[model samples]
Target: MSEAEASHRAIARWTSRVIPAILAGVAGYGTYVVVDRICIKFLYQERNQPAAIIVILILYFLFLLLSLWSYIKTIWTINTDTGLVPLTRTPPSRASSKKQSRRKKEGDIESQPYAASAAPDSDPNSPGLERFYTKEVFICESDGRPKWCPDCCNWKPDRAHHSSELGRCVLKMDHYCPWVGGMVSETSFKFFCQFTFWCALYCAVALATSAYSLAEIIHEGRPMDGHIIAAVAISAFFGLFTFSMTLTSWRYIFLNVTNIDMLKKAWVYQLAIQVPRGTPSTDKYTTITYPLPEFSSPQSPAAGVNGHATGPTSPVPAQENVSSARDQMATKTFAVVRTEHEENPWDLGWRRNWEEVMGTNIMDWLFPIRKSPCARHDVVESEYAMGTLVNTIKERYGLDKLPREGSGGIEMRDVPRESRRSHRSQRS
Candidate 1:
């Protein structure tokens, strides 16, 4: 590496190591001051309550251990599953290579579709095609190409984003947090949440105990101990910080969204419909932008792939004809449009989403030792955001299903009845 590049990497390594160490040192020192200096040395000793002091010390140590475990586990998970390691396709086995060579010699290889270009022939109805259609292959919508990460020299997986600081793609990345000295991602999210919770809990407990002692000192008109003052102030500040962090983390978990998801949504409109170059001209078609209704009126002209309208209909077509035409139009339109936010396929529903990331076992939910269901699988299968609510609304509107492309491209006005009810409920 060049001197400048080497210097940059050295700085990153130093910061990543030093920041977390400093945070840990501060936390450890504050805990020691509160429990040993204030709670035990002053409060418990003054009251001659040796048993209470011992119990408090034991609990303090237990919580401190748990916090350390969570922090370490979060860091470990991020390191292992950040998608930084380039994944190249495995080479064909010798037997397969020989067979391919024979086929080539027999002049039959030319007729075979390239593996990169064709769907698997073993199963014509393979779910792979559906995955590609849904943008789960991490293909770029701008030009129908796979999104390549130059830093990693690999194709990015769905929902994985490149982190400039880390110089790699992180799967389902939330953000690079300086406080944690690492990127928060799919594998580490649960642990990160647990860390925040434990940190806040520890700080709050310390603050409560220290505040009590401080109050006693004031009531007796005695000078407060310097250690007690320091503990109370540090605990109060960190307690609020960690508590807010915990709340924010849980909010995103509940919504089945991430900070990155919100950021991507801000530019979702840039993904426009792209028509194939050879599409036939339709004089009577309508070009509708995405976020269209689940079902348009029969009189509404079919939209072209280019978001243009064709000429007016000659007459009322049969119901079946209208449905078929609409489906065809939708399919063509969807094929060309970028799938960035086409559907939050990762959102299964509030309950399922929570269960997937937080674990079904109540104990596991409360702790960070056990792996979450989502962590077991590399790829996360998702559905629409608020899927249950959306389905209920669609059924109430006599719409049998969600939009063909999952609720990403459709408009709220297309389903006004559901939108109105949602609005009223929100207002109330």
Candidate 2:
């Protein structure tokens, strides 16, 4: 198999393992909950003590904490090893034949290349460049030939596309997010971490509070209205919380892809469409001779292949360099070593806040969106952004109507509502 395919397979294999583990954990927790319920009944009926509830609550919290901790550690690595943060340096090196040093100096801050490209160099009458940055894949140039692949969808932004992990094209594409929910955005990551802590605490508190109340009811042989109200209130709170959590997890699962990886996938798909089966990409696509936009010397190219120079401002020549530069090598993406400081995605201040409040006994209000997936407004805003992306794609790619040769469409208002709805449902 080609290297890229092999790497994807490896990721799939590892991710599959996580799926089973999560499933098993869920099953285990269900079993525990059931057993605890039964035990509580027995203890109250025969032993006649409130301690039973307390004991069960402790055990339940312990298990919840354990599961949450494991998930946090695993997901955190994706952000750390990948370019989720500024990535002052390159990301960590994966196992591969083409090994190279991928470090960077501290304080070399950078953002997505597209973000910078969104600003105009000098034209006053010209619209802001951001209008062109789309979330869907499609050809921008009318002269560009229709190179469609059944396996992949057309992305309008050219470079902005989707990663399989993230089910949709992301702005300033990075990589797929794999946390139980999805991409590790500044907002989402914070919620994910908070969700972990709060979930454990919530579970513990509910369990303790419930058991104590039940014990009192059993011992007193009376149903107090206040006790019953409290129970109902707790249940209501949990139901709402669970509803929100489910939404967050669903978002993660559907769009777990990143901006960087989106381009990589789109690039590979284009190459695949152009090349015949069994054909390999040239050395240019496989090896990195320079750093990426987020890590290159201000004067240097974004990256290179096999020691060849690839500048930052310009893309590798599309036609001439196709043969010698990016020969069909099969590998589509490369991971490089990056510095820790450059990798801070949470904004400098947020990371500091995380370090400070993490594991501390602070007022819960201090971290409002401390649960996974953060808040609903953030989710809604992301959707709104996606809507804009769809419109951009329609403008660039000529929407449902195929583009005429040598011309690309770029009218955002032209996209059909049904198509956008269809894509949204696909994600849902």
Candidate 3:
């Protein structure tokens, strides 16, 4: 390796080792201030109040140990050495066989589904996941080609995103988080959320006790202990931080979304339609946008390889394919404009969404006792987001006239309504 590359690696190794020690020291110091300064020092030793100290210590240690255990579990869940989080995998994580894990060991993150582009017959070791392909495998374009990630040189499935940090496509990757020390992705997301939750409670208790003690001291016209002051500042800082984190993490999880998905909400979702270059125009076709728009949409594009322009702000390039469909017929791409509310097609409603990431059992929540359900290529038919997605697909391709895509001629609106009813019934 080059000298500069070696130096960078060395520095990274050193930082990784030292950073954990620094964090552990901070956690240890906070624990000391709460248990030693507030609980034992002032309440028990100075005031001789055993019952009060006992109650406070019990509560304090409960949150503390729970938070610590959760943090460790989160770290364990994302362990780079073990391929704890997914690099790629076929089966849902909770159900991954030992042979499957051995084959795709990197994929152990949350319960969200991940369908590998690898066909079952391509690799001898392939676990049979049916190699489900989404609409992405066809119409989506980058460099005028369908392969989603030019960097990874692969056709990514729906919900899979290329993580420049990890240098590969992550299945349902949330974000890279340093606080929990890894990618808050499909595998480790639940552990990370639980960690934040327990930490929020821990910090809340720490802040309350320290602030209460400080208030008591001031009210009595007594000086504050330095350790008590330090504890209060640390507790207050982490309390607000953890509380906010817990709220945001669970919010995304409950919505069955990742931070990446949130960022791409406004990007035009386009599908390239290929037809013979001399085909007659069909631009009069109309799209019925959901919560249907206040104004009607512009006419559909004339069938061509690359010609019709989209909205002024639309990012769908007025570019042509140099490969594939361009070898014969022309291509006509359509932008399926969706309102912000309907953008996410993965939302399965709150309960299933939550269960997808965090699991459905008490022990699943209480402990890091199980893996999250791996993301499936095929979302359940009852999912609201799935309905929105299927609805958009139906509208974009003029499937309204063709009954082959779905059952009967149920209006697209009926799909989400049925899904909503399903959610309501299960919720009830």
Best by lDDT: 1
Please, what is the TM-score per model? 0.61, 0.29, 0.63
Candidate 3, residues 1-428, lDDT tens digits: the string is 22443464465546545666776887799888878888877888878988977877888889889888888887777665222223244332233323233433464321112234221222212221112211222223311122234233344544566553444566667776666665567777888888889888888888888899898888888986888888889988988998998899888887777787676535333333222222232453222111111133322222112333232122233353123222212122223222234355565678888888788887887677676764323343221225246465556555444423222122446646766898999999
- lDDT score, candidate 2, position 261: 33
Please give the distance, in angstroms, between residue 114's alpha carbon in candidate 3 and its true position after superposition. Answer: 23
Candidate 1 vs candidate 2: which has greater lDDT? Answer: 1
- Per-residue CA lDDT of model 1 for 1-428, tens digit only, reads 23444565577767877889888888878877866787667867776777766766676677778888898888887666653434443434445534444544564332232333221222223223233334222223332323334333344555667665665567677887767767888778898999999889888777877888789888999887888888889889989999999998898887777787776523331121223312332332222222222333211111221244322223354673444323433333222232233455355767788887788878878788776676555442231122443333324433333234434333435556666787999999
Poorly placed runs, candidate 1 (over 4 Å) = 1-9, 50-55, 85-140, 150-153, 265-343, 378-428
Ranking by lDDT: 1, 3, 2
Candidate 3 lDDT at 258 equals 75
> For model 2, how does the per-residue alpha-carbon lDDT over 299-376 read when each residue is reduced to its tens digit?
212222122322222345556334321222221211111112212122224333333223233543224324322222
lDDT of all the models against the reference?
0.56, 0.35, 0.55
